[model samples]
Structures are given as C-alpha cells and as structure tokens.
Target: MAILSSLRRRSAAISVAAVAGAATVGVCLTVGSASAGTVSGSLYRDPSSAVVRWVAANPGDSRAAVIRDKIASQPQARWFANFNISTAQSEAAAYVGAANAAQQIPVLSVYQITNRDCGGASAGGAPDLNQYQTWVSNFARGLGSQTVLIILETDSLALLTCLNSSEINARNQAISTATRTIKAANPNAKVYLDAGHSTWNSAGETANRLRAAGVQYADGFFSNVSNYNSTSNEANFGRAVISALNGMGLTGKRQVIDTSRNGGASGDWCGDDNTDRRIGMYPTTNTGDNNIDAYLWVKPPGEADGCRYTAGSFQPDLAFSLANGAPNPPNTTPPTTTPPTTTPPTTTPPTTTPPTTTPPTTTPPTTTPPTTPPNTTPPAGDGCYASVAVNQWAGGFTANVTVTAGKSDINGWTVTIALPSGTSVTGTWNAQASGTSGNVQFTNLSYNGRILGRQSTTFGFQGTGTGPGVTATCVG
Candidate 1:
C-alpha cells in the first residue's frame, strides 16, 4: 500500500449519562493466549471538533444530520502537531481538563517528532530532536493526573527509510526520550508509540523499531493511525508485534488501533476520494481484545489527505459519505407530517422522569414544551428561516439553531430565540449571545457571519429548565 500519505496527523460538558459510561476495564497483557477481548469505557467526545464545527456552520446541508450524528458524536484523538513549544502546555491542559471534567479519558496524538512523516505531504515538526523533546515535555506536563491515552509521533519509526543510519538513531533516541518525558510527567497517562500499520511493516520488524524507539517506556504501540486497515487485521498484527516484543523482553505492552476509517480497506492509502470508505468501529476502550488497549479514531474522518483538498481541512460531503456508508448509518429518513390534530392530547407521556412528590419551584414542568423530533423547521418569513433541534434531559437541554439566508446572500444575521418561561441559556458557541433566557439573541461570529444564498449556519447553546416550542426568527 502507498504509505506516503498514511501518516498525516490531524469537549464537552459532564453529562451524567456520559460519566456513567466512563468505567474502563483493565487488561493484563500476557505473551501467550492474548484473546480478542474488548474493554469497557467511554472516550471523551469533543463538542468543538471539526465535524461539530462544520455541522454547526452548515446545518442546512442535506447530509448534515447524518454527519452530525455519526462522525461528530464520536471521540477522536486531538493531534498536537503545530510546533508551538511555548503554548503547548496550556493547550494540552485545556483539552485534558475538559475531558477530566467530563469524567472520561482524553485520547491525544503527538505528531511533532523531528523528521516526522519523512518529509511527505504531512511533513514538518520541531526543528530538531532537542526542540521536539522540549515540546513533548511541556505537553506532557499539562496532562494533569487524569487518565489520558497518547499516540506518539505517527510514522516516526515505520518511515525511517528516508533517514540515514545516524538520523534514524537520533530519531529513535528522541522518541525514547519523549516517551519517558511524557510518562514521568503524568503516570496516569498511557503512551503508545507508533508501529505503522499491518500493510507497512512486518510484525518482527515493527517490533524491533518500536523497541529501538523506547516501546519499553510506553504503554504499547498504535497502528493504522491514518490508514485504511480493517480492525481484525490490525488486531492480529498487534498481537504479532506483542509476541515479538515479548520475545525481546518488552512484555506486558498493549496496543490501540485507529478504527477511524477502516470500514472498507483499500490499497490506495492517500486521499480516499475514489474509495467508498465508511467509518470503522466507534471509539471506545471496549475493543474485546486482551492485548488491545483501545480502538481509537486517531484520524478525524472527512479530513482531506492532501489529494482532493488541502490536508487537514474538513469536507462536509466527504464526511457525509463516510457517515452514510457506515454499517449502521444514522437514520436519514425525514418524518412524514400528518394533518394537524383537531384536538391536542390531554395527557402526554412525560419526556422526563417526574419528581417523587412536588417538584422544586424553579423546575419547569417536564411535560411543558413536549419533546419534538429533531430538525423541526420554524415558520419561515422575512427573507430567512431557522430550524431547531433539541436534545433534552431532565433539568437541562441543548439546542442547535440553524439560520439560513433566503434567495439573497447575507453579510450578517441575528437570530432571536423566544425560549420557554423557565428556560435559560448557560453557554453558547459559534455565535455571540445577548440574553440568558427568554427572547435570547444569537448573532453570528465574524467568520460565520456571511451566508451564501440559501446556505445555513448553526449556533448551539446549553440551557437550564424546559425547551422552547417557539421557532427562532432570523434577521439580516
């Protein structure tokens, strides 16, 4: 397979539902009898991911719903590729901190090793081994005490052919030091060195390179990070590498496979423009394998691999394709509308569980503003229209309001949402907010202010109390 472009490297509130799924099963690694057993745990889902941002910016696209539910909702590794040594610590801290708040483990990929990607399309990193080591140290220092998984320097070992013997030695030494630095900073953090994919290197050779690059200091090794390889094949390769590592006295190491885009494996490893590749298994600690640590989405799907578009940029159509092609793609069938009922039901089942007795004075009635199906379009008028999708829990809810311009393009727009009596906005993204509750106005940010004719942009907010039955009104 062409591995030249394979190594390209590229939240959220504490939901009670999410925190309940944060329990991770520990696996004891043994050389013999490494059965395919998945562990159990919830990976952190970043609300600010590229797909989420895209979904928020273009909610009116026909494929938005599928992409939103499939790709944007999964947990993927956030790559720390830019060689900004100074702000590395703070950036790492902020991301890990958010995951910590959510009671989930954060998966991070460090892609700035010196000589990364062998000067391929994804090339560029810290100037030298010394600088790379320093950057790694700073990034690790900010990981805090929470459990985090780190995929270290993708293709650093597998693509060693581009370097001279001296350069290879230097690169391995640098990775070794980086791994040690990360482990020393946060013992709770699990570091996995890159072992390339199954198609790139044989198990023994990959194990040898991983050992040389300090696999002994890491949790294990990660494979298929930016490639398209089936999970079963990658797992088998991982077991073989573990066997090799065990023979070399590096026992008890585990592996993580990038199940981001391996649903349909193809020989062409560059931009998957021609292939109909669907997203692989959803990210989780549950890989059902003793030797496999976790099945992660190392490469965020929909990102161009430097072929169809610029590398690392999100393409909505591509994202939708991957999502729609999944084995169990999100339901895209629109709900059929029936004629209006002559009389509203007197008693509707409660959308939320009722309190034992009298509810708190501040709590809104759970039955008020009955749960509406997602993608409900508001009444249209005034050269613009907006739609509301509400995801509600007992005491709180989140709303994604999509504002679309009419026949003419709009330079800017403001959306006024008349929230229910008891509802109040706590946080908002992709737009600026004016009011806390009723009659709240969200104005597009500078970047997302312009909407081409008939195009849409979305802004979301977390709210307290009941949701609004009213559709949002937009003005340019």
Candidate 2:
C-alpha cells in the first residue's frame, strides 16, 4: 500500500510537470538512466514446486541444467533467506548447506522482521521484539564470509503507522540491536535496513524511522526491496530519503533496491483490480545510481506476494508470468488475430517483333585497381566487448571480470564465451550461460546481466571441471 501510494504520487507529479513544461519544451524530456541486471535463480523454497519437482525428477535435464547453469553462471546474486524466527536455525543450516555445496555466490536478504508487509498481506514476525533479535543474531552467525548484502527487514520502517509509540520504539530498538549484532558477527557483511521506497514513505518520514531504527550502526538502508517501481524513480526516492537523512545529520549513508520484478513501475497498488500492467526489469547487481549500492533481485521475480494463490503460497505459474512480464487480462490465450485476404486477378498480353541488330564492341584500356580491405576488428579493449580472465581453481575456476566500458551503468548486451571440455560451468555473472561439449554460450548477459549501461559488475564461479588436467577456454 505504501509502495502503491508512492507510485501514485510519482505518476501524478511526473504527469503534471510534463504537461506544465510541455509548451516551452515542445517535447517531453524524460531524464533518467535505465536499470540493468539478471534474474538468474528462482526464489529458493524448502518445499519443491512443480518446476522444482521437475528439476528434481530429471537429474540432468537440460531445462534443469539451464536453470542451474544460469544460477551458477552469475557470480553474485541476491538470495532471500525468508525463514521465520521459529525455523531460523534449520533454515540457516539449509542455507549454509546450499551455499557450501553449490559454491554459488551469496548475497543474503534477511526478511521476517517486525510486522512484514504492515500486517496487511504478509505473515507477521515475532510476537515480541526479543525473539526477533535472537533470530537475527542466529541468522548473522550462520552467515560466514560469503559477503552478505543483508536486507534487515522488509517494510519494517514503512509499516510503522499501525504501531503505538511504545511499540514503535521497541521495534526500532530491536532493529538497532539486530544491526549491531549482525555487524559484530560479520564485519565484512554489508547490512542494509529497509527504508521501503519513495512511493511508500515521504523522505522525511522514512528518515525519521531510519534514525529511530539506528541506521548509523548498519551499512545503510534498502529501498524498493520487494516492489515494482523503476530503478530511476527508486534512485530519486532513495536520494531524497538519503538527503533527508543527511539533513537529520545521518550523512554518507547508502541504500540498495530490489530490481527483481521492477522492469517497469506499476501504475496501480499491489491488490488493485487493474490487470493491464506488465512486469519490467530482471535481476542483477547493477544500480543506475552510484549512491545505491546494488540493484539486487531482492524479491524473487515470480513469487506472488500473497495475492494470486491462497496468499503467501509459492505459485510457480504466477512466478513465471511475472518473470516473463506479467501480461494483463489474467489468462488471454490468443496472441494475434487473423486478417482476411482478398485475391486479385492477373492478365498478360504478349507481342513479339523480330529484328536483326549488329553489336558494336569497344576495347577499353585495362589497369589493375588497388585493393584495400575495410577495418573489421573492433577497437581493442572497448566496452562493446569484454575479455574476462578465467582462473582455473581446484574443483572449478575463479575469475574477476572488470568492465570499464559500462562501469556503474546497465547496457543490454549478450556475452558469448567458450569453456574447455569436461568442464561444466558452475556459476557466472552479468548474464546466463549454457554449455555444450567445449563451448559455453552466454545469452542475455547484459551489463551486470540485467542492468542498463555505464555500470561495473563482478561475477565469480566454482565448478567441478571433470577429469584430471581439466581446462576451460574463455572466449567471447
């Protein structure tokens, strides 16, 4: 609801400003950078679904392989650890196991703090604050190294309207305590408290909440963690919130956004009856705004937010629909309409006249012409293409690819590279890759795999490159 409200305000402001300035401007000048990133993995759930069941059923299925490959291909991806405090220990163990076994990159998003989603749509968190803090501390301990980009709680600060003063204070204290505990546990961990988004809370109000929650102790705040608003709008909103925070003397704080489902911002609220909206943006670590740390796929793109199916249940169909851009009108099957055809009659008349003609031949002087070929090779080490370095490690390979071409920007482009035989790609970044005998194909590997242009991203992976003396070729 807060996100929806914020989006409404943005839409109105943008519209009014466009109309008022249209006369002088002649054309509407919308100024903003696009977001980029890749949504490689599904929202990991303990209980499997139809798709997951299928993946489990077929051990080496190509579809399952593609999904795994896509996930393993990306170096860093935002993983939402949605386990509640009640099951925090087990969930944490499972998470650790998955991280260790997969050797996939981890960027954790810790949800389940305070009343999630303002008690409107989501299952609320710990009935008391102490339990919440305990859960958070345990969760932090579980995270060892593996550089976590922790989203402290979703909508915790934004959903403060429902709580009384005492309740609010208690909740804020709990968050502050949790922040200190997590940071103490892992100094390398980048903890981000949720600041909701611009559409949800005014900059001043959100800043007040962040201050109350002790944002100073944390890395910064997170915005648009699980909503569908454009990164540009979210960035502007984040800047405003940060500015307000700075005004409140909370300066130099940063924020990250959930770019998992916001390919484009929705015009309506979460539960609005309107069905014409489509999902925009994929998942990646590229943020258009420099101040924003990473545009992570905080919300698993296709996971329903307690709407489409029995509220809070994982609906794979809905997830898939949302992933592939949620087309409107629920279940409209027809893609196109057939056009009627009209045929025209054809008539031909032939008249032949025979005539003898003598051909005149003229001899022209022959000279050898100079031949030169146009330059076909691209400029060396340009942004258009990147030559990534792959370091073959024990069970897999490790490499860090630096992009100076589109640093801190998201550009839509694909990355193609080849890997050596017997070496299956375990993971990657900025894009998804499918591998054959010796050739590994990366498709839709945009800047950060899902970000716009002018951004820099790092992807690393480990794989069981089969056979002794296994090697891989990094060819784009």
Give the candidate number with the greatest TM-score: 1
Cand. 1 Cα-lDDT:
0.66
The TM-scores of all predictions, comma-separated, are 0.62, 0.52
Q: Which segments of model 2 are wrong by more than 4 Å? A: 1-87, 93-97, 100-104, 266-279, 325-476
Cα lDDT, model 2, residue 10: 11
> Which 10-residue span in candidate 1 carries the lowest summed lDDT?
11-20
Model 2, range 55-132, lDDT digits (tens) per residue? 334444334444322221122233332436555655555555555554433556555565644454344456555456
Q: Tell me the lDDT of model 2 at 276.
A: 36
Please report how far candidate 2 places residue 162 from its true position, in Å: 1.6
Global fold similarity of model 2 (TM-score): 0.52
Top lDDT model? 1
Candidate 1, 402-433: lDDT as tens digits: 77888888898988888988889887766799
